[model samples]
Structure formats: structure tokens, C-alpha cells
Target: MNKKDHSLLTRSFKNISVLFFIVVLLLLFVVILINVLFGIYTWDRLYMDLINALVGVMIPLVLFNFLYDRFTQQHKDRELSEKITETMLLDEQVIDRFSNDSKKAFIQKSTESILGKTVGNMVYDTLIQSYLSKSYQYRHHFKYYISYLGDKVTKTFAVDDETIFIFNPDDYYFVREDLSFERDITNFIQSNDVRIGFSYKESTLDGLYQRAEFMFRENLWVNEEHNSMLQELSNHEMEQFVKSFLQFTIEIDGEVVPYQVIHNEGYEGFHLLLDIPETLHSSVLSKVHIRFQMPQLRTQKKFIVMISEPTEDVEIMFMHLENEMEVEAIPFLNEAESITRLPNDTIKIDIHDWILPRAGVVFVWNDRQ
Candidate 1:
């Protein structure tokens, strides 16, 4: 290296050191000046120290409050969900109890009168009431306008080994995949021992009437034990029925979502499991059409038998018989062996047997729906 280059490097290094010293000295001077001013103002150093310490404390405290708020919100959300589910379940029971012979004539008369006045109105009335009775709330998002493609829409209702459901002018577009509303609905129906059928309105009031007439005729003429009136169907008859009649949309954030309600018997308690998209699990609300049959009162206690998720926690609500003098206390008798894993996610439960009678079971979801 040349002497001139070495001298230039030394000078540059000296300047850098002086700048660094000035910066450090300035920062120290600011701190000292702050302390002196604070002292002159008769401020306690300990108090100031405590204030600073509190600021440090508040940083975490603020973070903790934020976390706590989130957690509390979640808890409140879960509680609200549970309440809605419970109300929906109760409404289902009320509607089911109302659908007996006692109310059948009233329903028919009202339904018939409504049908005469408007097309596809009969089924709409029934579905709306049935759903509204068991839902958080109900709103007619849109009016159904019936237009017939053919001469008449033929609907056949038949009973077989299993109960069948039929309704006209289906709003299948309301079936949403995100809400798991279908699952919630099926659970409500099964809990109440109900079944349902679905149909839709075509273009014109006449077409709606024709479809309603078909459903009414089928319901009246078909044997009470009939599964379906339509014959020559393959093994997937019920599947076909579900595909054709029941139309629904999943409700999320007050928006209607498109989905199909596929009949499922995989779970003993429920007859249908709605295959929904994963995205809808958290925000979707469900509306189910169910037909509940009152448990036969063969003895002093009404006994109902059902199968459900063995490991699942369930809540039961019973409708006290009107004439009964005293309500019987429910006794749960788990007959199955201790299982680490539930059997087929189903355990047969008897509501009234040798011990107790006339009880209903409601299943609570862990907000997965």
C-alpha cells in the first residue's frame, strides 16, 4: 500500500469514530436531560420507574385482554348456537305433535283452502310452519312462482317399511353445503321420530294445484305403511325420491346457498346426512322438514327406542302427557359394554322400557355444524 492511501484511510476512520461518538453522546445527553427535568419537577424516580414498569405490564395486559375477548366471543358463540339448536329441536316436537289425526283435518282443510287460492301454496304453508316452528327464525327470501312444463305434475306418496315424506314446490336451491343445516335437520327429525317428503311448484297456479292434488291424493290413498307409491324403482328408490322432491339451500350469513339433500341411513338416528362443502361448517344455518310420530303409549310410560352416536353427549326433552298425573323421571340405562370407540357411531337407546317411558333425546353439536 502507498503511504498516501494509508493516510487517507486513517483520516476516514477518525471521522467515522467522531460521528459515532457524537451520536452516542447525544443519546446519553437526552436521557440525562430527561432525568434532570423530571427530578426538578418534584417527580419521584420510583414513581416514574413504576409508571414505566406499568407500561411494560400493560403491553402483556393488552395482549391478554385481546385473547380473552376472542375466547369469550367463542364461548358466547357456542352458547348461542346451542340455544338455537335447542329451540329448533323443540319446535320440531311441537310441529310433530300437531300433525296427528287431531290436527290432520285442520291441516288438510287449511292446506286445501290455501291450495285453491294459490298454486304450490299448500306445501309452502306446511313447510314454512314446520320449519319456522323449529328454526332460529324464518323468512320468505323469495316468493315461489309456479310454471308447469307439462299438463300436470304427478306426485305419488306411498308408505313402506319406513316412513316417507312428500311436499310440493321444493326450494332445493336453499339447500346449502356450508351450513350443515341438513345434518342438523335430520338429527332434529330423528330425535322427534319424524319423516318428510318434498315437492316443488311449476309455472302456473294450475300446475301448483295439480302437484298439490297429486301429493294430497297420494297421501290420502297410499297405505299408512306404504313407503312410496311409485313402483318399478331400483334399489335407490328413496335416493331417487330425495333427489326429486326435497330441495333446499344452506343459509350462511343470511345468504341462500345451493346444495342437495341426499337421504342417508348410515346413522341409525338420522335418515339423511347432507353432504356439504367444508367451507360452510361454521356459518351455515339449517332448516329441515321432518314428520314426527308420537311414541305409542302402550303402558303408563311412553317408550321410544333409538340409535345414536354412543360416545356423543345428548340432551333429551320430553313432552309431558296432558292427562298424566305425574311426570316420570328419566333413567338412562346404557346396556352396551364400555367402548373406547362408539359402535358405528350409534347406540340403541330405549326411552321407555322396563324402567321409564316417553322420553325424547336431543343431540348437541360441538359447533362443528
Candidate 2:
């Protein structure tokens, strides 16, 4: 037998020896008790005759046997108790080892499951259905983290940041494979109560696989963004201005980035600047295009068109000006108005000026040129 088997046999033998000794000792005690009871039953007649002659001899022998048996039994019990304790200790160690190994196996399995093809497909598909399905509507607020899907797209927006955009797929645009995008959308239902939900769509899949993939990751529809928008817009006095629509354009090195517009809303006369994904940010600033909506207001002719980076540092060249005034209203005409340089490159163009009460200004950003 192997060394391990031999050791196991030896341990078993020791336990068996302890048990045998305990049994033998217990049997001797039962025999002694039976003999004492029998002797007591005949004590008057038998012991009376034999007591005088054998009592002295019998007493010493009986005492010696009793003492010897008691010590032997105690020794056997101690050995058995020690062996039992040792076996228990060994069993506990084995149990602990098994528990730890099982836990490790479970952790490995769980990790594989989360990243597995089936689970990924399921998550992606659910997200898509939540948006495209007629059961729910997504409005102004949208959110998502792109890196979780290996750097897809990430964007966060308030309700007031809404802009509308249109796209023409046949135009010159950069396309890359293996890109996936996810978003949580909020919109109002016909009942006036705002409904919130999650949806995800990816760019890689060909044809209908695209729609099938996003339906699997749908989760509970919650109204957290609605409350946030209500509080912010009400506090800012911009509540009446309600979000119109939103659009996104991805640009890389002055080239258009091709992305399917899953949804859009509120795209009339307001100028909008939708944040393009940073992967395309550098390309945008290299040669950027500001897609702005023209104002339908009557006073729009009085105000000149000027675009400046929100952080006014260096004066970027002005794009368009109204001809109604004898003089041009140039933004960089006053150098002091320039504040600080943007840490990162960005493109800002003033499509139309903010008007007073005569013409309320609403800027909408759209992706469509």
C-alpha cells in the first residue's frame, strides 16, 4: 500500500484498539455486578458458613481485583478519549480544507459566468429592448458608462442640456468595428408621469443582430433622474424652457464619426452643442463643426452671431454676423473679455445671440448638418 494509505490504516488501528479496550473493561464491570447480586441473594446461608473461614482471604482478593479492574478501565477510557479527540481534530481540518477549495471553485466559476458570451449577449440585448420597445419612452436625461463594455461611450446629461440632431448615414464618416454603447433614458408617458428606464445599443453587429443584442440587459425602470431635473430646473428658473431634444456627433481628426442616432427630440430653433465622445474629441477640435439651429424670433436680426468657448481666454475667429447694424458686433473686439484658456481643445460657435423679452432664446444642438 502507499504511504498515505498505510498512515490511514495505522490511525484506524489505534482507534479500534481503544474501542476494544473500553468494551472489555465495560464487560468486566457487568460481570462483577451480576456476581455481587447473586451472592447477596444467597448471603444468609452461604456466607454464614464460609464467612468465618474464607472472609479474610476473599476480602483481600476481591479488593485487589476491584482496584486492578478500575485502574485498567480508566487507562482504557483515557486512551479512547484522547484518540477520539485526535480524530475529531483531523476531521475538522479536512472539513475546513474542503470548504476553502469549494469557495475558490465557486469564485472562478462566477467570474467566468459574468464575462461569458451568454451573459454578455443577455445584458446587451436587454438594454436595447428597453429603448426601442413601444412600452416605454426615453426623454431628456440620459446616462451610461462605456468602459465597462471595453471603452464604448460614456455620457451624463441634465434635462436642460437637451438638444436635437439629425443624421445622414451616407455622408463621409469614420467607422470602427467592435464598438458598443449603452444608455439609461428618461421620458414622459402620455399620462404626464415621467417614466425612467435603461437601454443599450451597439455599433458592431450586422443587420438585425444589432436590435436582438440590446434587448437582454433591460432592468427596473426608476425615476431618479426626473426628481433631479425637477429640482435643478425649478431652482434655476429654467423649468419653462423644457428640454427640446439631443444629438451627438463623433469626430476624429476633422472627419465625421459614424454613429447610429438611436433617438432624438426637440430640434427646432435653439442652438445646441452635444458633447461628442472623447475618443473623437481631439479630432473635433482639429477641424470642428458647430451644428446649431437658426432662431425663428423677429429680434434675431438685431443680435449678431458670435461663438466663444464658455471659458473665454483666447479670441477664436468669429463665424457669422447680422447685416442689420451699420457696424459688426465682433466677440473678440474687446480683448479684456477673454478669460482663461481651455485646458483641452474645444470648438464653440455662437449660432445666435440670446434675445431679451421680445425674443426668448432657445438653443438646440443637433447632429444633422
Candidate 3:
């Protein structure tokens, strides 16, 4: 029966029980009055008979109520099980799409809607355990992690079998970016403007800030047109020339932020170590701005931005001096959501979905020959 029908039946049964008890009491009072006035039976005999009748009636009534309640509960459980099975059959793909943790949560919510909080939790435990057992199969020793009611439990399942590990989605970090590059071909210079926003997930430090790192790398390649002059410079002179043309500024939320730079021994890049202020710790999103100007030689036909972190949204725009150069931008490894060319020799590419590291955009340009 449905919940409403079950409730109505229970109420009706309770009312019948109360009415029967009242009727018994009235009958006993009438018997007592008859014995006192008309002497229908002796007081001792009447009391004994009354006690036997009461016991007989009460015993059967209590037994019937107990059996009925048990049957109703069994019916409800069976019905719920059938519904769960049907849902699984219809939404197999949907369920498979959810991560392990999300699957557990979905099961809890779906079951809780049909049962009381306490019973729902009990049902959730049984269902989730069954799901994990069937979904995860191992022949030998396997270490499995399961999240039950917000608690994580790790246990070895099946010794002498292949091991399988499940990764937690929460452990993944994601960031968003808005990057722009402006080229001034007249001076062989390019200005880069980047804005990054992210949130902290894991950290191990004390104080009002969390330590983070950012790396920047720029390489200069000489072509036939400029090889003679560049090749004449010594290694030390070349490094100095590259450093002299690079000017950058870092800011957090509009205010300038300080960082310690660590230059690579043999590379054309450096690393910046800074602390994220406590104000943007776990609650608020943090925004970092990096702007830099570097030499853009004629031989450098392409500028690539590599995604080294999990990114959700990225907007890249490239603007060059009109009538000076032509550029084309393309996404590597993944397709962009939108690519638009605006006025003033500008091109913009946007990626609006989650993209993993190593996938990024490449901008290729050439002089207007």
C-alpha cells in the first residue's frame, strides 16, 4: 500500500482498539451492578470469569496487530526495492556518469525521499554496500576507499587479486584564465596580460596566507634575417639582453603582490613564489594578474600558452598592429567553444569547459609580405 493508505489503516486500527477497550470496561461495570442488585452470580465467580475473558480477547488482539504491522513493513520494503531496481535499469547511463562519491550521495537522497530519516539511512547503507560490491570486482588484493555518510573508509578487498584505485574528484584543482597578447611589430615587442582565478583545496602551512608558485618561460629564436647579429653575442650577453627586454608586474585583486623569483640554471624561465592572503583562503575566490612585455623577434612565428593546471574557462585574445602582421589562433588537443575575429586585427578564442593540463592554444603569425 502507499504511504497514505498505510497511515489511514493504522489510524483505523488504533481507533478500533480504543473502542473495544471502552466497550469491555462498560460491560464489566454493568456486570458488577447486576451482581450487586439482582445477584446474577457470586462476586468471586464473576471476577474470575471476567479476568479469563479479558485475557482471551487481549491476547488475540495483540497478536493480530503485531502480525499485521510486520506484513505491512515487509510490503513497503519490497516495494521500495522494486522501485530502486527500476530506477537503476532506466538510468544506467546516468548512474555510471556520476563519480563514486556522487553516486553514494545520489543513492542517499533518492532513498531518503521514500523513508524516514533513520530508516532511510539504514536503507542507504545496504544499497550502497551492494552497489560497491557489484561495481568493483577484483581477483586479488585490492585496496578500496569508500565514503559512507561523509566518513571515508579504506579496506582491502580480495587478496591475491589485481589492485584498483579510485581517485577522488574533490582532490582535483581547477582554475580560470583571461589572457591577452598585444603585438607591436614596429619595435619587435609584445605585451602579455594574464588574469587567473582559483581556489585552494589542500595546503599545509600556518599563518594568514597560503604559499603558491607560478612559473614563466620565454624563448627567443633567431631566423636567417637576424641570425648574424644574435649569434655574435656571447651566452652571458644573450641572457642579459633577454632579461633586459622582459618587464613584468604581479598583482592580487588589484593590489601589487610581492614574490621571490628563482631563476632556472640553464633555462630561459623563472619561478615566482608568493603567498595567497588569508582573506581569500577557502571562502572567497582569489584573482591574480600578471602583465609582462617581452621581445618578439621576426623569426618567432608562433606563441603558445600551455595549460599546466586543470582549467574550467579560458579566454585568449591576440591583437597585432593592423597592416603589420596576420595571425591565426587554434586550440591544441581540444576544440574551443568559440573563436571570433574582431575589428583592429584581433582574434579571440574561448574554452568554456573543463580541460586538463597540456592542452592549450597556439597563435601563429606572419609579417604582411
Candidate 4:
């Protein structure tokens, strides 16, 4: 039984014993008064007889109550042990029979045979506390199972991510971001500063080659000056200019890997095919470095880094290379580990620990003076 039940039982026994003793005292007092009124014995002799009677009644009552309580406790303990044993047997699908009571008697007995009983009980209690907790419900079993499998299949942890923003001498900003992470069947998507985009669903035939597509919207100039600078360029020249501003490279285990980029039919963006080695599918680490430039016409800008998978450490730095600017960094769904401002006009934000998906940092900046 639990502690609350045991305590209630003990309290009830104590109350009953007290009530019985009180009734016995009242009966003995009445008998003594009747004898005195009838003049059968002197007051002192009556008092002595009353004392003897009281002693005889009280001793047997106390002894019988003690024995009864001991037997009752023993019975309850046996019942509790039997219940636990039956539960364990049912959990293991053991045949319910007297002869098989000792067969597969849970982890407690199995562990006790190897370790001592004390250590075995400790292990058993720990497991019971964890798996058989009161908070656990049978209805949530599927939910818990799905969560376990999701963590296993989609497990990707980032080792390090560093993004640096440098203010250029011209009316453009330079950004270089480097990221290292463990990959599984992960899809990496990259896009420019476009309002709308689309991606092709990954497809594989006969488990050999995979095909996918990435789309980007046509460039939307923020100001007339920005539009005039690239208005005279042909389609090919515009594509080259855009490509020059946005460059992407990837490496696996410190070796450069080749990838194909093909222009999609009737689309503004291109299709990419990555020839990832089968041997380094999920076991090896990969790094991606991207360099891009943003025009100054977009005065108020927000640079957001969204975490799509588990990550360990992330750092973002903003360096004032040319002009002064006002910058503020904010973390979503979590607090940053540290934000430091260096002596060389650099603001760095660091986050350490396992950051879940959809939790990320946002850097907002605007021109000053």
C-alpha cells in the first residue's frame, strides 16, 4: 500500500483502541459504585478489587490489539507483493500459474540474481519511476513513439555557424556566412532577396538518381537609382550580374564538392543537382559558405537566420567597415548566450546549446546620421 493508506490505517486503529479503553473505564466505575452502595465490601477492599479487574482487562486488550495489528499488516504486505508480481508477469506475458510465479519475475529478481538485492531494487525503482510514472497515459503512446522516431530520422546538429556583415565603401553591403553541420537526407535551399519563390519536390528513380528544382522571383529594385544601374543589361548580362552578387560553395570533410546548376524552363531560377557521395550521406560533416551583396537602397533591413534542425552553436557578427549604423539583435523563442561588442566596431551575438527548429536570431539594422 501507499504511505497515505498506511497512515490512515494506523490512525483508525489508534482511535478504536482509545474508544474501547474509555468504555472499559466507565463500566468498571459503575460496578464499583454498585458494590459500595450494597455494602458488600469496604471502600478500600472495593478499590483494590477494582484495580485488579482493571489490570486484567487492560493487559489482554492491549496484547490482543497488538497481535491483531501485526497480523493485519502482514496480510496487507502479502497482498501488495502479490499484486506487484501479477502486474510484472502480465507485462511480460508469462502464464499465470503458481509454478511459474518465479519465472521471469520482472527485472527486480533478474537483476537481483546478478547484483545484490539492494542494487536490484534501486534499478527497478528507477525504471518504474521513469516508465510507469503517474503522468504517463496510455492514449499518448502513439504520440510518444512518433516523437522518438522523428528525433532519430531527422537528427541534424550544427557544429558552428558564423555570419559576418561588412559595410562596403560603395552603396552595397557585403555578407559572408559559413556553416558546418551534420547531414542526413537533408534538403538545403538558398534564395536571393526575392518576394516569392518555389522549390521542386525531390524525386528518385530506382533508388539511383535524384532530381529537384529551385525557383526565384525576378529582381525587384528598391529605388530608381538601383533600377537604372541594371536597366540596360541584357537577360544574360542580368543573370551574370545577379550571379556575381550571390555565390555559394559547399565542402564535405574539407574537400570541395561539385554541383550542377541548370536554368529551369519558363522559370526565373535554376535547378540544382548535387552529387553527394553515398558513403558520406549521414556520417560525415559538411560546410557551406555563401557570399552575397545587398544594395543600400533598402535602408532598414532585417537579417534573419532560421534554424531548420537541431543546432549546437551559432554566432552572428556585424562589422562597421565604412559608415555608422544602428544595429540590434534579437533571439526568437530563446535567449542568446551572450552578445558582445568588440573594440573594432563589431557586434557579435553567440548562442550555445541545442536550439530547436524555428528558433533563431534576427538582426535589424538601419542607417545612422
lDDT ranking, high to low: 3, 4, 1, 2
Error of 1 at 109 (Å): 67
* Cα-based TM-score, every candidate: 0.21, 0.18, 0.41, 0.40
Residues 184-286 of candidate 1 have per-residue lDDT tens digits of 3333323432222222111121222222111110011122222233323333665445444333233433444333323333211112333333444453334
lDDT of each: 0.36, 0.33, 0.48, 0.47
lDDT string for model 2 (1-369, tens) is 999999999999999999999999999778666766877534465457567768668888999999999999999999997785466446766435556446444434444467785765564455333433434322111111111011222222344455322222222111111111122211111222211112211111112222312211211111334324323333223212223212333333445633222222221111112323345422212333212111112222222222111222222222221121122323333323322222222123222222111111111222322
Candidate that would win on lDDT: 3
lDDT of 4 by residue, 174-246 (tens): 3444444443223332212111121221111111111122211112223444344344444554444445444
Instruction: State residue 85's C-alpha deviation in candidate 1, in Å.
Output: 42
Show model 1 residue runs off by greater than 4 Å.
1-225, 228-273, 281-307, 310-313, 320-369
RMSD of each: 27.6, 22.1, 20.8, 18.1
Q: In terms of TM-score, which candidate is strongest?
A: 3
Q: How many backbone clashes does candidate 2 have?
A: 34
Model 4: number of backbone collisions: 0
Model 4 lDDT, residue 31, Cα: 80
TM-score of 4: 0.40
Q: By descending TM-score, how would the candidates be arranged?
A: 3, 4, 1, 2
Superposed by TM-score, candidate 3 places the C-alpha of residue 289 at a distance from the truth, in angstroms, of: 0.6
lDDT tens readout by residue for model 3, 188-307: 111122212211111111111211122223333323333344444444444443333334455545657554443334332234444444443332333445554333334445665655
